[model samples]
Target chain A: MIRTLLATIALALWQTAALAQTNHQHVSGSACGEAVLRCASKVTPAFAPDGTLWLAWLAGGQVSVASSKDGGQTLSAPVAVTKLPLNLDTGPDARPKIAIDRNGGIAVAFAIFKDKAFNGQVFATRSADGGKSFAEPRPITSSSESQRFETIGVDADGSVFAAWLDKRNRIRAQQSGRKYEGAGLFFASSKDGGATYAEARLASDNTCECCRLGLAFAGPGRPVVVFRNIFEGGVRDHAVVSFADPATAGEVRRVSNDDWRIAACPHHGPSLSISAAGTYHVTWYSNGKARKGLFYARSQDEGRTFSEPLALGRPDRNPARPYVLAGPRGTVMVWKEFDGERTAVNVTISHDEGRSWTKPVAVATTKDTSDHPLLVSDGHKAYLSWMTKADGYRLVPVGDEP
Target chain B: MKRRLLAAIFLLGSLVAAPGADTTSDFKLKPFGRGSWQEVLRAHAGRPTLVHFWGATCGPCKVELPLLGKFMKEHAGIEVVTISADLVPDLPGATRAMLEKAGLRPAENWIFSDGFVERLRFEIDPTWQGDIPRTLLIERDGTITTIEGSAEIPVLEQWSTRQRAAPK
Candidate 1:
């Protein structure tokens, strides 16, 4: 009888294993709830010039900043930088990005969604005393109209640059500053650590209606901003706009000649990272026949010229929403690979700058629910944060194995 | 034959009601009681298990309970196990009251043992990070057919039908 019972158990286990093999892939961890934006999942870790870690995430719809003064072993309680008002959007705000200047001051920036749209202004609060406390949030723009899809970057000299998909250029005035309502990419800068700002300037006359703008600091005093550049022919291609200094201003330059022509907006925009050696590395997804998979382009002379683009993912992989982090010796690129009905996160490392990269490694196997895997590097240690159906946003340390 | 079936029901009921009854899946989960979950899984192995993880303070859970009770009643064969993920020991009484308000029968309940979140997540699937209100369906062969969140009755019935029709 005992032998028979053991046989039954073995049979049951085998049957389960076989059945699971069909629709299920053995994942590294068990799955949990559907994809959501929970309080604990937001992650934004920026390395100071001296290697101090400043991580920021959104908690209960408010922006929270935490500092790990001694590496990442311990993190301080998240202090709120954005005052999430009562009338703010119902769901938790998107994850906030943090940038640390040479002097150790941190500027955390995030956009608030209202009425099922990105209506809230992008705001940033600075911490002068190593992130122990944050100053009051001063609005990047005080316009009551919707100013959505905004991204911010702070230079080593304390100059701050903020860019977004602006809709202010149409013949007929649009409501809520939405891109579909006659929008283009616009930027604003603050000369003194987010204290005072200049008037918003239209960086690129071309832009996509649905994609968010990506802005990053190319060097100590320079800035490189990339967004979906809308052209005269309505061919929406990734455009790179740069400035020697935020105060002096510069014209936006269309980076690549992919000329992806699609009637509808793809919603996937380019992610740019500036390396320590002053190279602006960018990666984005385009489905135009000639240039399909994920593409990597870099500018050796700051923002002037980009090398021939390199495909990062497999030929058939629909790579979308690329997030790039330029490390000491390499650039880490994370993107979602759309495999038919399912989706998974892929990571690649570039050792010879953007010229070549390691074969893509599948990090997290997720469903169609995950979005925009954000890359954060503290120089030496790089981390990838992405939203999962079960856990809102999870942070995993990258490049630990090889 | 009908009498035999009734007799078997009574025998199983007595077996389940004996002083210890099969107090296994229904009572507060302990490490020892966890073995009973296997029995529960075996009993309902052919059917889908809707494991509703809820706390007393969750307003949304409260709003959805009546709907769940109706769903349980409508889907006769499916096993609807509502496990309280709450830490409070007094939760059992409050949970029972909430279920009573929703007109839930006594057969559809269990309180997760302490530290269940850590153990159960891995035990269910190594890839699972902890998230509550997690519903998983275990096939007769011990295969997990579908895993998702807060599925309503029709969807549960659809999954059940799909599981039954799937090739062995």
Candidate 2:
């Protein structure tokens, strides 16, 4: 009897501790002070198979995942995915990504800063019990060199794929006294519901080092990735690579010929989504002679060729960080633009398979510091997720203008 | 209430004098072999100097390079120093190649050493938030005028003329 009573007391103390640490603020415009800069900056949202909204962010050295069943009207208490001390890279393009499988499996991937020299390691964690707890984090890359700017996607068959910019080849070339222009795109896949992962493989070399990679599903078990590629003479263009299986990568096709030849990281990445008609809708930012500002195009023949680029946003406005989401309803593109005074979150919808788009509409405005807008969809409706100092965090449905 | 009013006046006075009090001496920067930031300031102590911060990955920075080269060539009285905001780990070859391609080889160049980028940015200018292609015009008397974007040629020429004609 005494042993049972002691166990009950221990359980009670644990519950009290958890309650004290849980976050209860679910409303918009909540204040996130300067101490939690990472949380405020990189808020990524995902939708589960059951239409439940899940949001993930970095706060106080831990990755927190929160769920909302009422279409993000209210959020449940956040659960920590990793308990260990972590130095997360929470830059605009290097935030943690969340992807949920059909079986309620939760996967989160992020880069851990290894040292003061900006070297980082990519790690992923999964929870099989619906976010009650998470398994130990697994390293996706084994190299000591920097591996960061990760993207995660979940296939319909409950498989998880994580891709990142890896610098192992660059390090090896430097050691051998050879010139390496840029890093390589490497990815690892888990087929058995995050239980085990295959060996990491390189998709392509000479990829721009600092931009985030985009990953989306072309079909069941088929994942496509797009990233900035470094061509001959440092021309940074966008390339698409599709894989039938996670381990084998197909040919890398150049998608955008912006000819933005620069040696520095723009911190801007492209967005890709496959429509129901097997066409790819891509949007990106480039100030090249081919097309300037934000541009959009579609490929009907599996990225072998693309339509002529259609420019969006005004020439005077600095439009950047475009994100595209294609669903059964249509394709929606959201981007941030800075008019001379304030920044506005603009959106345009294309109903006829990206052939034409409605005029751009400004949905949100903020003069304070804010994050790049992200889109999360339930396969029928797309919602914009943005966090700003004036507006806190909001999940506004695309058509439900306020 | 009287004491509070006096304190507010004192605060206003300090706010007005703050810019003159702050100088390059408050910062400790690594020398890039061209010279230390302080040495460059001291050498051109009584002349107008243009300090431009750029990075190899920045697209606009590359676009502005030829313009900056033209500005440097046209204006002989103003000192121009271009600093690469790329991290210490990034290879300097790419930056050198960009400079060569833009015909900006004659400009004095520098790159940031490996350190906390925010702290370094704060040391350079307390209000700066580490934006690239940032241009600053430091007058002969240590007054600093900061521009968050690319410098316009007309504005640069006007500032240079004003600084050169200002009584020291």
Candidate 3:
């Protein structure tokens, strides 16, 4: 009898240890409520200048930042970037964006709910001491009109650029008894790190309001932004705007001719990366007549024109949310595909500046709902960050294991 | 002491084995200015009802709203209720203004409350993926037909004709 009892106790102890190990490997930080858990799924990863991986996610009305020194194998405890009451809009196209400056300065921009109206204001916060602490958030847009779906980036000169969907024009048009076809794309920049921002300037008007904006540095202080623009006849094509001076309105150029003239929200946006040879690599989703799936294209003359759109993924699979990252050796594109019963995160790599791409490799699969896969690079190595109902959150290195 | 330990284990096991809270049937939709879906459905319980889900930012919704509005005005016996699926806490005014511009401001217009959107969506249709500009036609006998994309006029007209021919 004593021998049987001892065996039973040993088995129980072994199971307890295994359970603890599993939980520690998956769950990060404290447990959140169900609503916050869903809200916390949308994550953005950034690589600091010193090769530190920084991830920002929304949890329980706060924007939290966690750093992983060992290439995302282990993460430090999350530090609150802002403690104010935040109405975080978390989804495939809406989440908090983080940018690490060249001098180790950290900046985060997010959308906060207004008091009376169901509108949002773009707010930004910065940290000088790495990600240890953050300063008070300041409104990026001066006007009280609705502003959301912001994307932030830092240039080589430490200048912070933020572009978002602005509704000031819509409100003004309403006052004038005219219809503003869609929201306007506006931007603001901070020269001396993230201390203060200049007045917002309009990049373009009639932009699709629901899709996220993509921003990448083209030159020293010039940052290029890509968004869905509402062209004539309501064609929702992609437009590129290069802000040579953030205080002034720059020229807006149409990059893709995939005239996707639809009257619906795809909820998918474009991703951009500048190669070492000064070529701009962009990937976006569209069901146009010419291009019918996720596509990749490159512009050699800085968004003036683009190459032929190359379709990615299989024809039968429904792929959405494509993300691109340009490393020193190659460019990687990651997207999610849903095949009726299962969802898979797939990746395709290009070594010749997106002129050609390899066959897509499925990195992860889940039978439940999952967030869009994100790609972040440290100029040498590219990593994929994903969150799912089955695996919680994972930051895995892509293209490192052959 | 052994018996107490066994009892404690039994209680813990029962607590863990119990099912989660039932949130599927919580169908309380708030009023959007005046009317709610519940009241509209109850008033026309025996008649066919059409529920249209739309968002202000959706491009396809812009094209479909006017068509739906015209259909509603032309058809008399069919009950049409439009619901704005805009992120409840972010853009209700925009949605309302857009609907007004599109002439889709029906008397039974409504918007989902902030948060719990997934739960409410599941309650509406378990298989729905929350796509915008979706249409649903409910027959008099409680049969529901959900169309993901925009519904054509002929589809609605046929459904309306069948609904009228059914027994009251």
Tens digits of per-residue lDDT for model 2, B1-168: 667655654543443232123233323233343225566677767778898887664545776888888888888888888887753223254466666566666677776652233334444653343446788898988888976546777999899889778986
Off by over 4 Å in 1: A1-42, A69-74, A83-94, A114-118, A171-182, A301-304, A315-317, A338-343, A365-371, A387-402, B1-168
Per-residue alpha-carbon lDDT of candidate 1 for residues A48-145, written as tens digits (9 for 90 to 100) = 87876676754333456776666555667666664432112111113466777778777766654321122344555678787878876555654434
lDDT of 3 by residue, A152-257 (tens): 8887778888889998999899899998776899888888566567888888889987788888877777788888888998788888887766565577888888
For each candidate, give its TM-score against the true structure: 0.58, 0.71, 0.74
* lDDT for each residue of candidate 2 in A1-402, tens digit (9 for 90 to 100): 332233223222322332222232111112442224233556789998899888887655456788989976777877776563244564446777899999888888877654333466677778888878877666665555778888888877778887899989989998999989768999888875664467778899989877778788888777889888988888878889988777778899988788876555666788999987788888887755466677888898888888888888866566767989886567888987665346688999888889988889999987654667888898768898887655667787884322
Candidate 1: residue A130 Cα off by (Å): 3.5
lDDT for each of the candidates?
0.57, 0.70, 0.71
- Superposition error at A285 for model 1 (Å): 1.6
| RMSD of candidate 3 to true structure, Å | 15.0
TM-score of 3: 0.74
Ranking by lDDT: 3, 2, 1
What are the fnat scores of the candidates, in the order listed? Answer: 0.00, 0.03, 0.12
lDDT string for model 1 (B1-168, tens) is: 667655654543443222111222343322212344565676676555666655443323565678778877776655777666542222344465666667664445766553223334334443332223355666556766543334466766787687557765
Instruction: State candidate 1's TM-score.
Output: 0.58
Clashing pairs in 2: A263-B56, A264-B56, A264-B57, A265-B57
- Docking quality class, candidate 1: incorrect
